[model samples]
Target: MAAKKPWRIIPRPLLETILNNHAQHHRVPQPLLLHGPRGVGKTTLILQRLLPDWNKGPHLTGYVDFAELMKGNLGTSPGPWASWSTCPQPRLSDCRKILEHCVESMVEKGVSAGTITSQQIFTTLNKWHGLTAALRHVLQSKSRASDRASPAALWERAVFAMSRECTTAEVGRILGFGENEKNGLSFEEASYMKESVAALKLAKKIIALQQGWRANAITHMNRTGLFSRTLTHSCTDWPCLLLEFLSQAAEIDHFQPKLVINNIEVLKHATVNSESTVSGPLYHDSLIWRIIALGANERCLPVILVTSDSYYSYEAFLEFGYMEIFISREVSVEGLLG
Candidate 1:
């Protein structure tokens, strides 16, 4: 038998094309769905090679496992529109905390894989601590006797205030800025705790928006007329937050943001459609398409949709011709990342 490779394998040309486009176009076409037979390794490449390196640049990087997201929703079990609930909205501080944890977790993996050093980890942790201190100081200095805001809300205000004080990228970079540009550190070696911290701070504002939308959706659930349309519009716009975050980072880093959506097939399962088609419950997919179209039009971020099965839909993503599909014959995480 031929010597078996260690990682999952993706088409070399497709990978090169993606990297090249990101370097030149400053944006990846949205819904660049990867279609292939089941067990072809599309999802493997996306999760390992693409998402990890994506926004870990000078600004922010985020990943949402669609399959996981879908599994969380009770509606996914009965087919589209069986039932739905607004996904839990996380606060900005909470977001940062999650990011920080992810990065720390990533670093541990990197070290085990011989990708980073102990000193690097400490430096990154210190940066996060410094930001936390700064945010606390800012919040205390601004508090007034009449102020009655909760601690979390006050922290959110302070984060925005901090955002306005420095260039957004600078703030973002502080949260997860790597020395790839000036210090010559590999992305893994760079400090990202700050970026995670910042994400936590930003989560507060995002939660408020989600809360309002959730309320509206619940209110109009009975009346499917104009309410359905309104509901779809609100939900569709949510992904734009990610787009905007990437775009702003591109400006700061002078590199287009590259994004990867892992486990695309799971989305079909995750999307909720209303049982009452006339009232047309919001489609889980509509939001995804909107995200792709907007990303392609803006051309600020390059997006890759990763899937494991060949069942692909053209109706949703035909406008962007830049998509490339890969089929995997062997299963190995090393090959995929390589």
Candidate 2:
């Protein structure tokens, strides 16, 4: 065997500052924007130091490298939906991919720490994905059986099946069911389950609409009467749907989830000049804004964005109105050398 490489992580003062603040405040730290030049070890410090430290606690953590996401290596699918010609660039599909990555990371950490069983996470995620897939199948199907029922009726049944499939037992287990002497879930747990189901139902609708858009069948969709004119309106607003899905997932285990994304500068390049009419920073108009809002909201998960671009300046963040959420910080190679 070749010589094994030892893990060597240089400690950074900035990481300590953020951790100390979080420890003292007993809340998620403000979103951090770690910017530096290439080879400054920003990614290394996050992956090797901060992430490991955060994972050691009750807090759940998610790590996404945009570089990896761009290369079609992250999330459940091999590549992003943008790879499909009909799909709008950096649309809801990208948001879904990011959320999937975070949820996967949360599950992995929860399982490894023994706070949650692998079976539970696997079962839950499978059921969730299955429901969405089933809805997609129904919308996309051309078989006579599917044609027998109106798409609206088929969609309602699919949502019902999904709700029924996500039983109290499943939600209970995820919420640490046996921790108390309760026979079943409490009102709050039930409420969360209901919310999760609603979000999933909406996701199915959104996915179906996305597929329709991809197929260039929006004209046909307008005639489907599945959701009336609202379908067209809602389909274009992917960020809201994505936030609902991710927020519920973050709240499931009552774990304070942290989303750490590296190489986020890749987004700047991806959104350089799109046909999207949404205003603000190129990222602010896309899925990134929703992510930032998620972090900013105390009720939702926190986010940490990492970049290696020196040009990602304070003025840009201020202009985007993200300065309040993302405090600028830099990790220098020379500082690490000392």
- On lDDT, the candidate that comes out on top is 2
Q: Residue-wise lDDT of candidate 1 within 153-175, one digit each (tens)? A: 55556644544444535533543
Candidate 2 global TM-score: 0.50
What does candidate 2's lDDT look like per residue over 1-338, in tens digits?
Answer: 11132223445675556543442222333555655444546667667766776665455666777565344433354433223223223443454457554654454333323333322322333432334444556445333235466434555555444555566655445444563447454676455454444334445454554545444333444345333323333333443443333344453334455666676655554432222222113333344554555456633455566664443443445545754545434332112321
Error of 1 at 196 (Å): 13
lDDT of each: 0.41, 0.46
Q: lDDT (0-100) at residue 8 of candidate 2?
A: 31
Task: Report the Cα lDDT for candidate 1.
Answer: 0.41
Name the runs in model 1 displaced over 4 angstroms: 1-24, 29-31, 47-63, 68-210, 222-227, 251-255, 271-283, 308-311, 317-338
Name the candidate that leads on TM-score. 2
